[model samples]
Target chain A: MWHDRAMSTTGRRVGRPRAERRPDSGLSAREELLAAAAELFTVQGYAATSTRAVAERSGMRQASMYHYFGGKEDLLAVLLEGTVRPSLDLARGLLAAEGSAEARLWQLCRSDVVLLCGGPHNLGALYLLPEVRTERFAGFARMRRELKEAYGRLLADAACCTALDAGEVAVRTDLVFGLIEGVILIHRSDPDRPVEAFAAATADAALRVAGAREEDLAEVRARAAKLAQG
Target chain B: MWHDRAMSTTGRRVGRPRAERRPDSGLSAREELLAAAAELFTVQGYAATSTRAVAERSGMRQASMYHYFGGKEDLLAVLLEGTVRPSLDLARGLLAAEGSAEARLWQLCRSDVVLLCGGPHNLGALYLLPEVRTERFAGFARMRRELKEAYGRLLADAACCTALDAGEVAVRTDLVFGLIEGVILIHRSDPDRPVEAFAAATADAALRVAGAREEDLAEVRARAAKLAQG
Candidate 1:
C-alpha cells in the first residue's frame, strides 16, 4: 500500500520481545511505526488516537516508540513528507529530462496520482487535518509547496502553456494540482475502482486543465507512455 | 459563511433561558447550533469535539442541544448534508433549465466552488472524515451522488460531449466533480483567494475537462454570465 515508503531503511532494532506479535510486513521498525500511525489516523479519527495506541498497534511499548518517533506528530510529519518527497523526486527527474515538457508533465501527474491513490489508507486526505496546518507541520507544508512548484515548472515548460500569462499559469497549476489530490475523495467513494485507471484519467484531466491541445492529446499520451517506460 | 444554511429554519426554540448571552448573529437558535458545530468540528478534530463543547460554543446548555440534533453524529450528518444539498438543489434546477447544457454545467461548477470556498469553515473537507463513511451518514452521501449525477446529465448533454461514449462521459464527469471538491485543498493553502475568480477559472477548467470545445468556451462563459443574472 505504501508505494511511497521512503526514509531511514536501517537494520531492525533488537527490542525486548513482547507478548503482542507484530506482523512481518518487511518494514523496518521506524517504517512499522509510520504504517501503524497511517492506519490508525485514517480508520479512526486522528484526535481520538493516542501515541500509546499507535505504539500498541505497531507492537512496541510506549517507551520504545520514542526510539523511532518523538510522538504522534512526528509520525504524521514523516508520513506526510513521505507522500510528497517521492513525487518531488520524480518531478525533478522529469524536469531534467529532454522529452517534451508536455509528456513529462503528463507522466509526472500520472505518477503523482498513483502515489496519492496508491496507499491503503487515504493518507493524502490527512493533509486536510487541522493539525497538519499548524506550525508543527510546516516542513510537510513546505515540501508540498515544492511539489506544487514542480507541477508549475513542468506545466510552465509545456509548449501548450507558453501562451498563458503568469497568472494563468499559476491558476492552471493550482487546478491541476487540485485535481490530483482531489482523487482521494473520488477513490474513497469507490474503493474497489482500479487505481491505474483512476490515476490515468486524472492525469489526462490534469493535462487538459493545463491547456494541452486536443489535436496533440494523442501525441502527448504516446510520448508520456514512452517516458513511463524509459 | 452560511451562504448555504438551510434546514429546519422553523423559528427559535423557546427553551429555558441559559446564563450566557448569545451573539446576535441574526441566525436562528438551530442555525446557531449548526454554526457552532461546524466551527468546532473543523477547528478541532471531529472526534475530539464533544456535543457539550458544541452546545457551549453556541451559548446554550447541553440539555437544550437535543431539541435540534440527536447527538454529535447528527450534527455531523447535518453539516455534511448542508454542504451538498444546496449544490444538489442548484444542479437539479440547472438540469431542468432551458439553455445550453454547457453553460449550465459551467454555472453549476462555478456556484459549487463558491459554496465550498465561501464558508468560514471548510465544511466540504468534513466529507473526508472516515466517520462520515459509516452508514449513519449514508443520506448525506446519497445527496452528494445526486449532485454528481446532475453534473453528468448536463455534461452528457453538452454539445462537446456527444462525441464520447458513456464511459468517457462518466469519467469526465468524475474529473469535473473531483475538481470542484478538490478546491478545498487549494483554497486552504491560499485562503485569501477571491472565490469569484477562483470559481471562474475552475469552471473553465472543468468545461475543458468535460470536452467543451475551445471555440465554445467564450460562448459558454457568456451564456453562463446571463444565467448568473437570470
Candidate 2:
C-alpha cells in the first residue's frame, strides 16, 4: 500500500506520483514537497508561500501535491512533527531508563539539540511561527508540551536539583527548555557549525541552569557518555 | 524638534502628525505606527501585513503614514531596534562598571530579560522573522551583534569560567544568549508570568551556563542586588 511504502526524509504517501516534470530530488514526491515547503517557509515568510508555489518548486503538478499533504498547513504540520518526534521519543526512553537523573537529562538535551539542529533546514526555528499557536497545530503543541514536561521530570529528579523547591524547578525547567529551543535561532545564523559539539555544549549549559554542581558534572558526563554509546 | 521627539515606549518622530484621526496611543505618530505594526505583524504576520493596514490600524491616513516611516520595512526596522537598544545601553554600562564579572553578567542578564519580556508586545520574537536577515535591517543586526559580544566578554572574564578555553567560552555564550532570547517565547506563552522573579531565575540560570559555582553565586547575587538598586 502507498501508506506503508517507506519514503526517505518524509512520511506517508497517498496517491501515485506525477509521472512528468517532478523535481529530481530522488526523494519520493511527498518528500520533495516537504523539502520545498521547508525552504520556502524558512527563506520567505510562510504566509507568502502558496500551495501552488510549493507544488511548482517541488516540480510536481499542484493536484498531485494534495496527494501528499492537504495544503500548506499540512506540510507545515509534518515538518514540525519531524523536528519534535525524535526528541520526544528519546525523552520517553530516557524517562523509563535507569540512569541517574543528571545523566539522563543531559543525554536527552544533547540528543534533542542534535535532532533539532540536524534537519536539512532549521525546522526548529519554525516553532516561532505565529500560525503555530492556532488550534490546527494543537497536536504538535501537545507533543511539545509532553516533551517539555519530560524535561521538567528529568530535571526535578536530578540529585543536584534537590535543593530547589517546586517553584524553582519549574522556573529552571523553563530556562533549560528555553535554552534548548532558543539555540536553534543561534544555530541557524551559522548552520555550518559542528552539531555534536554544539549539542554537547548546549546540554552542559542546561545542566548548569538546572543547578548541577561542577564537581558532580564529571560523573554525570561519564554516565551520559555511556548513554550515548548505548 | 520632531526628530528629537522622544515618545514613551518608542523613539524619534518625523514630520507633522496628521491633524485628525490618529490612534490615541498618547504616542507620537511614529510610535503609534510602530505599535500597530508590532501587533499586526506578530498576530497576523509580516508578509500578510500591508503598510496601509498598519496605517489604518494606527488611526492615521495612508498618505500621511509616509510622513513618518518610509514603508513597511522602515516600520519593522524601528520595532526591531526598540527591542535591542535598551538592552544594549544596559550592557555598555554594566561593562564599564566595577564588580565581579559574575555579578555584572547576572545584572545584565536580569535587566535585559526584563526589557525583553517587558515589551508592550513580545517584539523580541520578531527577530526570527525572515525579513530580518535582509540587508535593510543591518543597523538592528549590528546592534544585536555588539550586544552578543558584550555577553561573550562578560562570560569569558568570569572567574568560574577561567578553565574554559576560548572555544568553550564561545559555546557557553551562544547557549546563554540563546536562553535569553528564547525566554521571550516562553514568556509569551504565559504572558501573565511575573517578570521580576522570572528575570532573576533566568539570570541565575545564565550564570550557571557561564560556569559560575553555587558558592560564588551568593556574593554575586548580593552585588547584583546592589547594582539593581544603584
Which structure among the candidates has the greatest DockQ? 2
Q: How much lDDT does candidate 2 score?
A: 0.85
- Cα displacement (angstroms), candidate 2, residue A219, comes to 1.5
Tens-digit lDDT track for model 2 on B59-143? 7777667777778999999989988899899999988988788899999899889988896688877888888999999999999
Report each candidate's C-alpha RMSD, comma-separated, in the order given. Answer: 5.6, 5.2
The superposed Cα distance between candidate 1 and the true structure at residue B17, in angstroms, equals 5.2
Instruction: Please state the CAPRI-style docking class of candidate 1.
Output: medium
Model 1: residues with Cα > 4 Å off, grouped in runs: A1-23, B1-23
Weakest lDDT window of 10 consecutive positions for candidate 1 chain A: A1-10
Cα lDDT tens digits for candidate 1, A10-59: 64443433332346676776777888999998999788889999989987
Question: Which DockQ values do the candidates obtain, in the order shown?
Answer: 0.70, 0.73
C-alpha positional error of residue B85 in candidate 2 after TM-score superposition, expressed in Å: 0.5
Model 1, span B107-213: residue lDDT tens: 99999999999988888778888798899999998999999999999989998899999998999988999999999889888989989999999999999999876
